[model samples]
Each structure stands twice: as C-alpha cells, then as structure tokens.
Target: MAAIHRLERTQNIPIDLEQAWNFFSRPGNLEKITPAYMRFRITSPPVARMYAGEVITYFIRPLLGIPLAWMTEITHVQEGRYFVDEQKKGPYALWHHQHHFEAVPGGIKMTDIVHYQLPLGFLGTLAGKLFVNRQLEDIFAYRREAIEQLFGSMN
Candidate 1:
C-alpha cells in the first residue's frame, strides 16, 4: 500500500532566535550543516535573505555517489519563527518540510516536520522500511552533531 511518512526532529541550539534564524535562513548555509557524503550543493543564486516563493535548486548525491537534481520552493516564511519548503521536483512523489524556532530557557528550540511520500507505491513502502527511514534518521543525526559542533552544545 502507498503511504505518507512524517519525520519530526527537534534540537535546541544555544543561540538567540535571530542568530539561529540568520544561520538557517541562508540558502548557502545548507551545505555547511549537511553531511559531506550527500554532496549537497546549491545551484540557486545567492540572496540577501530568504523570502517566500524563492525557488532553490541543488545537486545532491544521496546514494552510491550518484548525483541528482532537486528543486524546492520556499512557500512560507514568518520571519524568525517558521518557514516551509515544498519540493517542486525531486526523488520523492511528495515532500513538504516545515521549520519552526522558538526561544527557550537557555537557547532557541528548533523543530523540523517533514512530510513525504515515495513514488513507487508499495515498493516504496518496503524501501522506506528498509532504507529511506534509516537514511533520514542518519541525516538528522549527523545534523544534530554538526550543529552542536558549529555552535556549542546546549547540554
């Protein structure tokens, strides 16, 4: 059966909301946080700040060192609070991601909610169970470490 999957991740960054937003809102900073193996490279032109309706393109080698082109649009933005990116063209049948940030006790709390669907129906479900799910987890796990390395740990 075809299915939709959601991946939610939350992390606390020991930085102010403006600092966190500045870092995350920049399209160029994506490569910095992403794992090198993914080879995430932005093809979009640089912008002073992220804005809604901005379409960004990238080349990523997610598996086997093979490169793939992905395009996504910044569909929503609420300044330092939240933003949503939806895939316009990519490997997935559907991909929508939302990022939210809020001030917490000692830092800013960042949360990511990703809703995606695979393309090949039941085969996709099997693949998600076998690989996709774990890969997503690994990517986020890497992100957590990278963020902490970039900015001191909150713990």
Candidate 2:
C-alpha cells in the first residue's frame, strides 16, 4: 500500500524568501536540525549549495539495532520556493519528499510532503501498525521542534 504524509510549519523568522532559502538550501544545515540519534550525514562530496540532481547519502537506524544506509537524489529544484528529493535506495519500498517554502506576512511558511511505501507486503503492514507509523511521527515532531528553535516561532 502507498502512504502519503504531510507536515506544514510556518516560522516567523523576520527574513525574506531569499534568506530562508539560502539557509535551508545549504547541504550542511541539515545536521543542525536533524535529530542526533539518526546520525544523519551527507556522504557525497561537499558542495557549497544544493541543486537538482545532487545525491546525498545518510546512515540511520530504522529499527532496533538495525542500521540502514539511505541515499536520495534531489529531483526537483525551484530556487527559494521548493525542492524535491526521492529515495534512490533505503529501507522503504519507495520515498518521495517535497520541501516547499513561501513568503508569508510574518515570515516563511514551509511544508513537507512525503509519500512512501514499505517493502515486504504483509510484513511491512505489520511493521507500520506496530512501530513505523509512530516512529515517523516522532521523527517529524523532532524536526518541527528543532526548526522552531533554529528559526524562531511561526506565530
């Protein structure tokens, strides 16, 4: 089965779209917001900025004591407004994520949309029921808190 999840967060950063984009589009900034438990890293050669077709690799623990190597490619880019990354190889059967940003009255509104499917058919279903779904939510929640701390409040 296919599942699509979305999370939207608006931040009152007192910055314009360009400023927001510059900070977010840099490759290394990911380490600032990502949870330390994931041990997220960019395996690709260091680049000053991000653009479409760039590939990033990371090491994560998806389950109890199971380390997974994940790689994703930036498939779409629209400068400051949005970007998309799809999984090239990972624990998921499929993963496509879109990160969008728009200038709002106070600051910038950001949204994350993720569409994914797990492998192993029935086993995947069981995993989702038992743990994966909750784990995903927790991960995103951590991201949300981190972003707020980094950029300030949306309200």
Candidate 3:
C-alpha cells in the first residue's frame, strides 16, 4: 500500500471565525468559490443545512478530458471550528480532509489539511511526479486567490 500524501495550507481572512465558518460550511456556496475550470457540481440532493453524514458528489476532470466522479461524506463536525470529510468514492484510494478555523488578531485563520493516497500502486506515484502534483497545486492556488477576492485582503 502507498503511504498517505499530505498537503496543508493556512490563510488569514479578514473576518471573524463565525463568519468564516458560516460561509465555508455552506454546501451551495461551493460552486461559487471553486474554480471554473474544474466544473464542480453537487450531485447530491439539495439540503438546507450541512452536517456530519451528509454526502456530497462532484464531477471533475482532473486531467485532459477525463471526467471523474467523486463523492465524500462529512465524517465529523464541530460547529464554528472544524470539520472533516472522507472520500466515499473518488480518484484517490483514500482522501480525508480537515478544515479548521480559529480566531486571529484581525479576523480568522483558516487551515486546510488533506491526507490522501492515489491508486494504481507505483503508476500513481509516477503520475504524480509527471503532472498531478503540479495540477493539484495550481488548483489550490486558484482557490486561494478566489477566496481572497471573495472575502477581501488577507494581507
């Protein structure tokens, strides 16, 4: 089995923890914040609120023209603080992401920690070396910029 690969990023947003959490935790708001290139869509039934056990499905093309269907379940939650989601079905052999928010000097500090493992054994490692890793980085970079635009200056 391949070892889990982890990626973490932190950003300070100019808003209180409650405001940040309220915005980030909403389900419908995902499409507003995600990059356009990814074509992210929620396939699960629409819900008025999100909580642990809620399943979210998305369709994305991680590579050139290859549409991948992914699904994850909200596995844990702590109101206005943190939440964890684990992949039920996705490109990865395993995927678990934890989102945390904490009160900071001017506003709030948000952190994203993703732990995942690719499939296809050694081939997955080679793929990551070739392009997946860079693509993933770019995707997140776009997300960060989008969030900055949405919430205002973090600097």
Better of 1 and 3 by TM-score: 1
Better of 1 and 3 by lDDT: 1
Candidate 1 to truth, TM? 0.97
After superposition, the stretches of candidate 3 with alpha carbons farther than 4 Å from their true spots are none
In terms of TM-score, the best-performing candidate is: 1
Residue 114 C-alpha lDDT in model 2 = 84
True lDDT of residue 38, candidate 1: 95
Q: Model 1, which residues run further than 4 Å from truth?
A: none
Q: Tens digit of lDDT per residue, candidate 3, span 1-155?
A: 87688889898899998788888888777877677877787878877766999999888876776788999999999999999999999898989999999998999999999998888999998887888778777877887888898998768
How well does candidate 3 match the true structure in TM-score terms?
0.94
How far residue 10's Cα lies from its native spot in candidate 1, in Å, is: 0.8
- Which ten contiguous residues of candidate 2 have the minimum total lDDT? 2-11
Ranking by lDDT: 1, 3, 2
TM-score, predicted candidate 2 vs. hidden true structure: 0.89
RMSD of each: 0.9, 2.0, 1.2
C-alpha lDDT of residue 130 in model 3 = 87
